[model samples]
Target: MLKTILHYINVNRWRLIKISKNNFLIYCSVFVGLMGGLAAVALKYLVHFMEDLSRNIGAHVPFHFMYIFLPALGILLTILYQHLVNRDQIQKGIGTIIFNIKRNKANMKFNNVYSHLITSSLTVGFGGSSGLEAPIVSTGAAIGSVTGRFFKLTTHQKSLLIAAGASAGIAAVFNSPIAGVLFSLEILLGEISIPTFIPLLIASATGVVVAKILYSRQLFHLATEGWHLQALPFYLLLGLLSGWTAIYISNVAHKLEKGIFKKQNRYVRAVLGGLILGVIILIFPPLLGEGYHYLQEVLNGNINVLQEESLFSTWLQHPLIMAGFIAALVFMKVIAAGITLGSGGNGGTFAPTMFTGAFLGLFVAYAVNLTGWVHLNTSNFIAVGMAGALSGVLHAPLTAIFLIAEITGGYILFIPLMIVSAISYIIARLSNSHNMYWHDLIHEKNVRPDKDYEMLTAIEIRKVVNRKYTAVKRNRPIKELYKLMAETSTNIFAVLDDEKHLQGVVLLDELRKRIVDGTLSATATIEDLMIEPPAVIEYNQSAEDVMDLFDTLDVWQLPVVYHGRFVGFVSKSNMLTEYRKVLIGQHHQPDPFGH
Candidate 1:
């Protein structure tokens, strides 16, 4: 029966492939959108369920007091799950997804489909200072990837599916379909082809519809008073502040991961991180979990709601004190999110970015209003600030703008949103070349796109190394070299010692010149015909480096060496062929989904 089922599947798969690419993708998009939406809803339910359970356990304990040990336990459980059950490292959230697209040809790990849901639920549900959007994005991308594999989809189709999944997941979470589509195009795929856009639009719209059906509440329903032109300068200033804050978030998270948590034992690091986070939570309960509730409080001009819940309620009532507290949140949020995720919490920076943006906007508005120089609507500033921080941190201005507009019920603060996002994006670009996600892939792995280098990055030297070239002993007779040339295809040969250590190379063209001159005797040795190669190519050398060497040396071919042994010869021609292949993979191929 199992064999028959397998046979049936194979036959159906063939039929599916026979469908036109565009129609098949349209069909897959609907499935991916529906599934991605369901995954988002399920993740939200699990998180809320865990949160309710944790709350029940802490019913008698003060909210701050309960977090002292809750976040610690959650981190420990997350770490143990990875170590004992999953037995794999937690990934770098959406960065890994983009890396897979660029370097791994969109082939995603199957484990990501469910692992993020498990670990992130545990982390955020139990009060870890993190977000759910990243995990759900990972889950959605994995869904697209596995589905592509199941149908044996083309590489382009697989990539589109992955993008669609990501967009859908984000759309479901925020109930903002346009933002979802923009996020996939701006951040994930980095290209805007019409063929890709249709599927993304369908998936994102479907995801949002599902989210609405299951959980009808919009993420943020801000009554944003229209922005005043007088506040334009202040908005610009807020943009700069948000840009700097974004830099702090990106750098602090990256530094903590590399410097603090990198050397410590995983278990020990997780404990220390959790304990520290708990202390912060005890001091600033708003930083706990997703912090969305606190964000609403701030935007609603009820910043004192958090003060009422704090141990220092009396001290927090002072206007200056309240302002300082809110400002401190903007800076400390970076540390809170960094430590939580750096120490093994399975959550993303998405929620934290929004959290930081909302509070930062509130702080800026409150501070400016206190000065009596400008009258700014606190809610308007909060919405604009969200866009500003998002633009800077995620390097996505359009997404930040549209997401804030849609969630806020309309584009009432459109001008301020555009101003803040544009300025913030520019400032972020000046601070760092790549956004929070792409920077790791570029600086850590050297996988960023460069017209000359991207093709080289995708291919390895072994793929183009000419193993067909033969090696001759340095002592072999020149007359024997003539006999060897007759037997072989072309001119390049490595002259090596008995142990195969490359001594030098013999060019058949040069040897043939000598042969034509009639200056070689039967006893003339290959050593006499050999000369030091201008440059030797290492088998592991990057394609860019190899190409650079070729141009620098003006050589048509270079002998390839690997760990003190002669491997083969690599020619300029082979490099060009590989580069063209890469170019085709990246750009030149006919659209897999044509109209």
Candidate 2:
């Protein structure tokens, strides 16, 4: 029934709306945004519901240690679900989405639209240490990609809608429309213009509206007396600290994730990772789940919240102990998050980054205040620190700046936010050229940043190979080659051994020249007439490498060999034609909605 309705709408869209392609795209963006916002709302409500349920159960139970087991149980359940139902096929993280957009023409599976919604809710709601933002973005991008496919849109249109969904997801999650648009542009789209910006703006605004109407609670509330010029140097120091901290978090989290998953058995990995994560949470209770409640407490100057359920509760009475506890939370949060995700639990690092940043900021302020060296506003540093850490970790300064400002309503501290975020970003970039997401993609997935290279990578070598070229045994008479050339339209012929291995190539031009110069011998074999090819392309070679060889060798055609056996000939003209088709498909915007 849903399919029939969608088909009807698709068939009559032009007649019903009579709008231009751009305007029609705007309308699609609205729907995508609405769906993205709804996804965010659903995820939030589910996670909160689970948290409340867990809290209620904990209140009634006599075993306080049971809370530590909750994370392990959640991760185990997530792993079970993945294996039993999802077939362990769900791909998590924002890097996967970026790779698909660049290398797969922005196509996504339909199951992704709801798979993340279910898996993330289960993982995060059960007290896993990760965040729901990455899952939400993945769900939203799938919605946009599926929607574009449903309407039979162009590749560019599909990509635009994917970005639109991601923007909406971020906007709705934080209730920050501008930050959402910037997230898409900075992280996903990489570059944008007016036409693209308008759709993203509309989509982000629509998503915010949906989130506000359905789930109206503000994400964070801040009461700041503004920044003081005297705090400039402190903010600068905090910025540098945040940068190094961001590097530490990225590296530690990445290493932990790698180490945990390196185990052979999935269940063993889960049990091991979950136990370690549970122990971390046990020592520093504030590291539980998203830790936003603790972040809020820090923001409100209630540093005491960190000790509520911690093993160090009694020891935190001393100033130095409390500072140490806060510092420990800052570092341990990333470890917990890495364990949660690597153990087969599904979630993102966005919340963990912010959570760590808030605590890091509080630690800096608390330590400085303890010395009585100029009273620094703890709340101001916390807010700026959140932006600084976010900027450094994600390498998205604009997104980090606006998202913090919008969520906290701390525009008064915009200067500090800018200062810290810029410094942190510079430091992080100096340490690692690519952000965490891009770094993983480049090293793990072998994805390249060059557009042409990626496009060529997507093209299959077999698709452009001229299999119609005639092949002759090396012992065949030269007259046989002449007879075959007259029968076939191909100008190139492959000279193969009895075992079908490529020995050499025969060119019609060379053959005609030999014939005209009276140097051709009718009794000569194909080996005598054939010339060695400048290069040979393996059948499984990448199109990028093939193109490089073509340019380097200055040849129009190259023979393809598979397992040392002759396959077919690939031509420069054919490769260029295929490349042009892909370029046109990605760049050309046809009028799907006729005027």
The numbered model that scores best in lDDT is 2
Provide the overall lDDT of each model, using Cα atoms, as 2-decimal numbers: 0.85, 0.87
Question: TM-score per candidate, in order?
Answer: 0.90, 0.89
**Residue pairs that clash (backbone atoms under 3 angstroms), model 2:** none
lDDT by residue for model 1 over 1-595, one digit each (tens)? Answer: 9998788577556655587667888888989999899999999899999899888888878766797878978888899998898888546478888888777767887888888888999899999999999999998998898887776676678889999999999999999999999999998888888999999999999998898899886677787657677888889899999889888888887776553467789898888889999999888889889999888877777877878668788998888988999988888877888888888888888888898998899998899888888788998888888899899989999999999998877587888899899999999999998897888888788878544665688778899998887888877677777677679887888888877789999888888788789887768888988999998888889888899989998998998888989888999999999888877765433433342
- What stretches of model 2 exceed 4 Å from their correct place? 1-17, 85-89, 258-272, 468-493, 506-531, 587-595
User: In model 1, what are the clashing residue pairs, if there are any?
Assistant: none
Clashes of each: 0, 0
* TM-score (C-alpha, index-matched) for candidate 2: 0.89
On a 0 to 1 TM-score scale, where does candidate 1 land against the true structure?
Answer: 0.90
What is the Cα-based lDDT of residue 546 in candidate 1?
A: 90
Mark the 10 consecutive residues where model 2 has the least summed lDDT.
Answer: 11-20
